[model samples]
Target: MNELDLIQQLREGDEHAFKTLVESYQDLVYNTALGIVQNAEDAEDISQEVFIKVYRSVHTFKGESKISTWLYRITVSTALDLLRSRKSKKRFSFLQRLFGDNNEPLQEVPDFNHPGVALDQKENAARLFKAINQLPENQKVAFTLHKLEDLSYQEISEVMKVSVSAVESLMHRAKQNLKKILEKDNEE
Candidate 1:
């Protein structure tokens, strides 16, 4: 079905349309979340949450932008929310640990390497992603959309609600920042 037809069906509460939506966009949503949150399990959870959000809130989506843009916004927002929640929990846990016997076991941080990387390249990929994570929010989103999602400047502009030139500037800055971060990592 065309996007228009799918959207209309979705607004009409068609079950098939919802299923098609999930099937068509799950990878996009999942990868975007993974790029942001840098965790596979959390990305999977965020992907499901994004769809549930779309299923609940599709009616609020005005047709001013493409469905994918809307999905991108939702995926980014949900992933960032998870990150913020995790950060707050971590901070609170640090405080809680100071005064009592903590029973929670600390797990090793999972390698956040891309799935397609070979074993030898996993370290490089993980290091690259860690630097990407350190970017300012706009630069990180633009870089992820362009590099990870293979989106053009026009597509990223639409998703980010920014001008194409702004996206260009963000991409340039992200590359420069990543270079510096990786260089520092190498030194350390």
Candidate 2:
């Protein structure tokens, strides 16, 4: 079915349509979330949240962009929200440990192995992901969508609600930042 037909069915609360939509875009949503959040479990949670948000707000979708673009925006926002909440929780936990009676040690999260990466490239991919994670939020989003998700500048602009030139600038800055970050890592 065409996107408009799918949207129409979704607006009418058709479960089958929703299921089809989920099946069609689940990989895209999950991969985008995984790329940003860098954890399989967190990515799965964010992907579910993205679908819920889509279901709740499908009626508000004005068809200003492609359905895929809308889904991309939702996935990015949901992943970022989860990341921010995780950061805040970690900060709160640290403060609690410092001030209170809690004696639990913080566990280190292992490096995420992206399933799409080749076996030989896994180590390099991990390092790249670490560098990407250090980027400012906007640059990170642009870089992930462009490099990982293989999105065009126009598609990223639509998803980010920014101009194409702005997306280009973000990608350029992201590449420069990644180079510096990787070089610094190597020198250490």
Candidate 3:
């Protein structure tokens, strides 16, 4: 069935349609989350949350954009929410420590190794991801969608709610930033 038909079935509360939708887009959602959050477990959790939001809000979805574009927006929003929550928790924990109630230690996120990357490229990919994590949010999203997800500039523009030219500019700046970050790391 076409995406429109699947969406119509989903709106009609067809369980099988929902299942098929999840099956088809699970990897896309998960990988997008992983790229942002840099953790497999968090990515998996965010993927589930993305579907939950989709199921709950599908009826409100207008057909202005493609389903995949909608999914990308959801995944990016969920992942960023998680990241913001994590930052808030870290600050809270730091305050608790300052007040002498420290019971929890700050946890560091480890380097992410995307499973789809070739074994020979895993080490380089890990370093690249580390650099990506340091990018400002817009550049990070644009770079991840383009480089990791292999999305076109136009598709990313739609997902990001920006013009195609804006996406192109973001990609260019992201590349330059990544190069500088990697170079500095190498020099050290």
Cα RMSD (angstroms) for every candidate in the order listed: 2.1, 1.2, 1.4
In model 2, the Cα lDDT at residue 20 comes to: 99
lDDT of 3 by residue, 26-126 (tens): 99999999999999999999999999999999999987888999999999999999999988989999999889899777787777899889999999999
TM-score (all chains, Cα) for each model: 0.89, 0.95, 0.94
Candidate 2 C-alpha error for residue 19, in Å: 1.3
lDDT scores of the candidates, listed in order: 0.89, 0.94, 0.94
Which stretches of candidate 3 lie above 4 Å from their native place? 103-105
Clashing pairs in 3: none
Off by over 4 Å in 2: none
Tell me how candidate 2 scores on lDDT. Answer: 0.94
Tens-digit lDDT track for model 2 on 2-121? Answer: 999999999999999999999999999999999999999999999999999999999999887889999999999999998899889988889889988577888787877899999999
Give the Cα error of residue 127 in candidate 2, in Å: 0.5
